[model samples]
Target: MALQVGLVGLPNVGKSTLFNAVSQAGAEAANFPFCTIDPNVGVVAVPDERLTRLAELAASKKVVPTAIEFVDIAGLVAGASKGEGLGNQFLAHIREVDAICNVVRCFDDDDIVHVSGSVDPARDVEIITTELVLADLATVEKRLDRANRTARTGDKDAIRERDVIEALRDHLGDGRVARTFPGELPPAVARELSLLTAKPVLYAANVAEDDLGQGGEARGNPYVEVVRKLAEEEGAEVVVISAQVESELAELAGDERQEYLDDLGLDRSGLERLIDRAYQLLGLLTYFTAGPQEARAWTVPSGSTAPRAAREIHTDFERGFIKAEVIAYDDYDRLGSEAAARDAGRLRIEGKEYVVADGDVIHFRFNV
Candidate 1:
């Protein structure tokens, strides 16, 4: 499955605007609140200059880039946990995502209505975080209730589960996420109780165009400070992007786009940085399968074993396990060809235990 990220925030925070800019899928972006009724799901090809360069060097006909899935869920409200404004339904969508891109409205636009009647990003973030925490607390309470029932019957495993639930409940009660409970949670417990706040989050500060390169140091943007502080505490990643500006940049021609970015003193699009940050948050790595017929990039988690990565290609390849012939893209490029790389001892035959690295060019040998 592709790494899924949920774009969540209060209404009118430019979540759909950022979504449209990054995915190039036209999701409705209106001035009214709650315009995005249903979730907009789009698969965005992760941009890697190395993959593009490899494709060019290989002279392959088809160039396939690895992709990540972004889900633009409805804007969450203050009482979302209590069934307010598409509440539980949207929270349910969040539970399915692997990570989150919390888009906070840092820009000021009188035309765009703020759901809270004012542009206060800190308050908005608190409201959304509170909802997630409340929802998680509710889940923890239910699990604790069930575990308590089983513990009364002298189930050792259930008693342990009850203890964990109590700890989690304490944390959630203090407005902290259950993920901060300080230990490795059992997979069974994690699977049974999908904690919304447990997912990794990247704060997307939807700033004004002038503040883009300020790195959140610009004055008058209270939300940037809030997000920066949160990121510092959680060791999370934060990125600044002007969704309105990016949307306009997306509509321009190639040279015109470059000129606009250059004028803004940016070397690349904010959308690219956002996507790259999402990939890093998910710990995703890319590997290429190159040949005359087709050249494609595949995405996998960083620590994925060779066999597991093979399954990403085909189940048959994984079932019929064999060694993988691997060459680093850099080495391949320097050596010019596979034969030259092998002769120079740059290619390696790795076993199933080998963890695939990013930028590896791999050829798998398998029997059906």
Candidate 2:
């Protein structure tokens, strides 16, 4: 399954607009709250120039890029945890995603209405985060009763899980996210809890087109700076984009799109940057398989084992695991061919224990 990043923010913060730009999917971008009742899902190919070059070198007929799934969830509001503003449904969508893209309003447009009646990035972030925290708190508290019961029966695993739940409840009570719960949580407990706040987040600061240049730079516009500071405190990443501009760009194709971006003095659109950041937020890596048939990119976790990566290609490959003939992308590109890379001793024969690296050109050798 493609890893997904869920778009979340208060109503009318351009989440749908940004989603439309990134995926080119026509999600409803209305100006009112609860406009997007159902989550809009779109799969976008991850842009990697290396895959194109590799396909050319291998004379492959097709080049397929790995994809990321973007889910446009409805806007979140205050008291969402308590079933306000379709909060229950929205929160469920968030729980289904691998990461969160929190779209915050940084532009001032009197024409569009703000749910809170003002454009305050920091305040808006607080409102959304507090609700997520509260929702998680409710989840933890509910589990605590059952966990406490099991722990009382003297099950060692149950005791450990109950203790972790207690710590999580305390962390949420203090207005802190599960991501900042001080120490590493056990895998069992972490999987069981699946707290919304524990998921990685990237902040998309929705700015006006005039403020685009100022949005991403180190010293950005004051509104972006406010969001930057908040992200800094939480160890999250921020990408600034003009949803209106992206919406416009999404309508054009080919050279026209390039011309539009060029006219704006941008090498690439902010939506592209946001997509890359969203991919990174999940700590995902891409490896390649190139041949005369096809050159394709496959997604895996950063430190996935060779066998695990083979499973991404096919369960049979992993079932009958053997060695992998791996070549680093740069080595293959520099050497000009896999044959030359082999002669130069740039190819490696790795076993199942080998941890796959990003940009690796792999040829799995398996027997089923």
Candidate 3:
């Protein structure tokens, strides 16, 4: 399963709208705050053209794409850690996610209200981040006291763990996210804390349709500039999109949507861009399995070895491991067929330790 990313922002910043567009989950996109009191979870296919090409070449009857989960969380307000504006519940929902998508309102619509009475992307981001830091600080503080007590008993492991907690405490005390915690924490100690701020985050700037193309390398939207500057400081990524426009496009079918996107001077949908960016942010890669019956895309960490990638398909595959017959997607595409690629000696026999590359086609040779 693909890792989940939580969508969070002040209410009415298009979190639900974006969620509905990407996942087609039909999350309620009301204008009022806390409209999404309960978290809405949706799974979306990770857009990959390679899977389609593989299916065609293999004469596969079915194609299955890898998927990612998105959770639409209610808006957060100041004093969230202190139980304001359903903050505790929202924060609890956030704890289960692997990463965060902080939606910042960049468009101005008189009909829609901003949570802070004005649109300030930087201030909004600061508010949400500060809340996360404060929440983590509280959690770390509770852990620190017990760790110190255990260290006082002359336990070496406890002493090391306590020192790690102390370093994290210092970082949180300075109102910084756990991802920026400078010291290297031991694996056990890090898992023991599980601080919320430790999760990677990306800023989603919801712009007007007119400003849709003014982000990333081409800077046109002033609000996107503010978000970009803040993201640079935090070492995070920024995905600029018009959620309202994408939501509208989501209602249309393939050709209709493509036509609309073309009319907007776009080659692809913003949802695709956002999904691709999130996939990269999480350090994810895709590999494929092709056969006469099915062609499927699988997601794995960037440097995953052959056995590990096989385990994603089935534990039996990993337990009864053997060599993997692999071919690069490029070779298959250029050769026009798997038979041609094999004749060209492009198909390779990869052992257990062979690291799977993105767009690799693998046929697992397992005894199980």
Specify the highest-lDDT model's number.
Answer: 2
Q: Identify the runs in model 2 with alpha carbons over 4 angstroms from their true place.
A: 183-185, 214-220
Better of 1 and 3 by lDDT: 3
lDDT sort, best first? 2, 3, 1
lDDT per model, in order? Answer: 0.86, 0.89, 0.88
Clashing pairs in 3: none
- Identify the superior model by TM-score, candidate 2 or candidate 3: 3
Number of the top candidate by TM-score?
Answer: 3
Candidate 1 local lDDT, 1-368, one digit each (tens): 58889999999999999999878888898887678888899888877887777776677888888888889998999999989997998998999999988999987789888999998877887898899999999998988888889889888887887887888888899999765778556799899898999998998889888887633234566768878887888888988888977888978977999888888877777778887888898888889888776789998889999888888899998999789999999998898877789999999999999999999999999997
- Model 3, 153-236: lDDT tens digits are 998988988898898899899887889777888887677667788998988999888777623222677888999999998789
Model 1, residue 352: displacement in angstroms? 1.6
